[model samples]
Target: MDLIEELMQEITLNNFDVGSSTWVDVTYINNPHSFYVRPTSYRSFLKSMQAHGQKLEQQDLQLSMNIVYYSKTLKNFCRGLIYHVDTAKKNCTCDIYAIDYGCVEKSVSLKNMYSPLLEQGLPPLATHCQLANCEPKNGLWKDKEIDAMKCYIGTEKAKLIVKGKTCLKLIVELFNSCPDDIATMLALTGYSTLGYNENVFSRIPNFKQEKHYYTYPKIEPGNVLHVRTQSGKDLDNFYVAKVDEYYDYINNVNNLLAYSKQAQSLRPEDMKENKAISVFVPQFLRYERGIIQKITVSEEKALVQLVD
Candidate 1:
């Protein structure tokens, strides 16, 4: 595959989502229950943004790719930098400006912007925004091809490690399934690619910065996984274990956590910091909005008690 480009100008009006919690980071200090910017006002706003960063001499505003109404109760106007606009989709990704990371996009973005161009046999120039809202959602050829490449490389690597040898079986349950944890499990002994998560597996290149990944799919439940130990251990002289054993252990641990006040945390690191979790695993803390119990299994259930 071609080299990665850190940031691609692909966010367009089509991709621009309106709402503080959804897409755009621009939020009104006052949550106006109702807000509406007339389409005409939106049209004008776009024109004014088109030539924003050009220069004082270049008197044109880059059409705004995004907009967020601060308040519906009062009309307040504030201007911000023109990051990108997508006219066809009638959306903008202005929320990126709020990112403290210097408004920089990543290398994988180029693939999103130019995949169609590559398909159309056109030279790729993703330095600027993809023509906004003009084309229908199309295939990401470059990105797909890259994933295909990774699959091939990963499968081959997995095969090489399991060749004629299965000693100590290791099954890891992630306490926190973030990118870091996903990557960590993938780097297990004897085989770095012996792990998979549906979400993190898709963005392997973005996270691991690698061209390939592999997983042992046939190593299913009830299957014994064996591995070699330290010195003096023969090739097959190792420990054997089943995948269900790991799950059962995790379930028991989760059960123990529920009753333990100190169990009220997620990751090992966070567990250390959480006085409650340090005391017990499944323990809960009494709060006004509902109790914040230990996130026994996954990160998604961490703070779900707070709901409006």
Candidate 2:
């Protein structure tokens, strides 16, 4: 079948790969501590997932197995689109960004792309791209991905969980991964595509939405698959690693600035410094309030310092 037909099919462990941009239901887990360590019976888990996918379709939102049809028409020069569906509350949020961004429980100034009108015919799918001329071809895609790109275009990266270990391959699919179910795993809290890091996982606004580009492995008719959420500890570790990485980056920037200053002071023959193209570039120290001040600029690099 063509792409459109695939998106319209009932979601299942085989046909649709579904994940929450925020949280997965924990009602199935008996003990939270042994969350990742224990194996989940694949049979019961698949049944639960299938039920959720069907609920979303009945609500009128169309989900694609892969966003290829939408992304192909959207160009990266513009912003990306992100949509959050609170199935429990039956509410949705949409956002558009020209650069890196994440969403919270609140709303933004952009028009509400989530509409009650899409319940008819073919509904639109989410994408991180924009179509040219604010118009798209008559296809299975939604208008927000094409015409309403003045906001943001967003897509989640995914990961696969199988045999109690994440598949090592770059691209993962569900065990019964069909062309129709393009499941992208989105983590709602402090994590990235690398899985959860407990120390570094922060609840900061833009830092949410950890996309796992994974696929599921097929199971025997009677066998079970233990699919569970990442442990809380792993979530924090992700943040710990991130903060350490930032510190290293800051130190490297300081060293480069010092070298640039020294080279500029040397004699023309000794340093051969090109006045037309200064080596030092200006940058800022970003914080919760945003760019507080410019820390480095050309010859003023030595004046910048970040304190813990």
Top candidate (TM-score): 2
lDDT of 1 by residue, 1-308 (tens): 22122112121122112111111111111111110111111232222222222111112323211222221122222222223333333322211121111122211111122111111111111111111111111322234333422332231111001011001111112112233332233333212333234221122444544222123246757865632121235656543324334322221222232123222334544422122322322232221122344566444444333210
* Candidate 1 residue runs with Cα over 4 Å from true position: 1-180, 188-308
Q: Number of clashes in every candidate structure?
A: 38, 55
- TM-score against native, each model: 0.13, 0.15
Per-residue lDDT tens digits for candidate 2, residues 61-158, read 33111011111122221112222223343344322221111111123222233232112222211111111111112323343332222111122222
Error of 1 at 113 (Å): 20
All-Cα superposition RMSD per candidate: 25.4, 25.3
The reply for model 2, stretches above 4 Å from the true place, is 1-10, 13-107, 110-114, 120-308
